[model samples]
Target: MSRRPITEYAVLSDCRSAALVSSDGSVDWLCFPHFDSPAIFGRLLGDEAGYWSIRPDGETSRTRRYAGPTMVLETTYRTRNGMVTVTDGLIMGAGNRGHDLGAGAPGALVRRIHCTEGAVRVAVIFAPRPEYGLIEPVLREVPGGLLIRGGA
Candidate 1:
């Protein structure tokens, strides 16, 4: 993947937490639960930092934008073989507009990708390092994705 400027990253949030996703579909930075909370992904700082990425296996061109006025991000990737779309967002709890993530509001990050055209191979890498890359989280495969834990 080609390196992109920090300005090319898109901001996604539920008003509780924020994630910076690169144009190439890499989640380079994310602060969970709250803006000041420990980071789960911080590759934006350096290669040794953590990151989670999902992208087309081969070469691809992409376009992205927020869905309406919401924090939901939609990225579409078009490859020689086909096209795919990825949607990312942080889900807010009932009755919560997420005005304050520091208020102990609960939420979850969600990523969904779907093939829209022909066929395309997809790639996914999930690495979680907490505490600003000071901790390498243990990962276990769950029925759907993974369970990650580290540091206090």
Candidate 2:
């Protein structure tokens, strides 16, 4: 994974934690559970520092913004074949509202993407290097999603 300019990154926060998403739909830096926690996706620090990427396979033009008044980011990628919108958010507490928005944080990140027009081949990469790339965890597949183990 390569590092993008800080200006090209979007900040996604759930009050308790934050993640930085690059212009190419890659999460280059993410520290969960707490603000001071070790990075779960730390590519910004080094080449092998792990990352998660989701994007259109070929050349694409990108645009992104924070959805409404929340910290959730909506990034749109337009390829020659089609356009897709990717929404990313560091999930906050259930039912939490203003003044108590992050009262019961869950420390989870959610990324959702959908085609807005036409169709394009998608590219996806998931690599988790916890603790600033010091821990190479084992990834297992379960019924609903993937599981990460063998890390402290």
Looking at model 1, report the run of 10 residues with the lowest lDDT sum. 97-106
For residue 117, give model 1's deviation from the true position in Å: 0.9
**Distance (Å) between predicted and true CA of 82, model 1?**
0.9
Candidate lDDT scores, in order, read 0.84, 0.84
TM-score of 1: 0.88
Question: lDDT tens string, model 2, 17-116?
Answer: 7899988899999887678988888999985778899999989898888888989899999999889999999887678756776565555788899999
Query: Which pairs of residues collide in model 2?
Result: none
- How well does each candidate superpose onto the true structure, as a TM-score? 0.88, 0.87
Worst 10 residues of 2 by lDDT: 98-107
Overall local distance difference test of candidate 2: 0.84
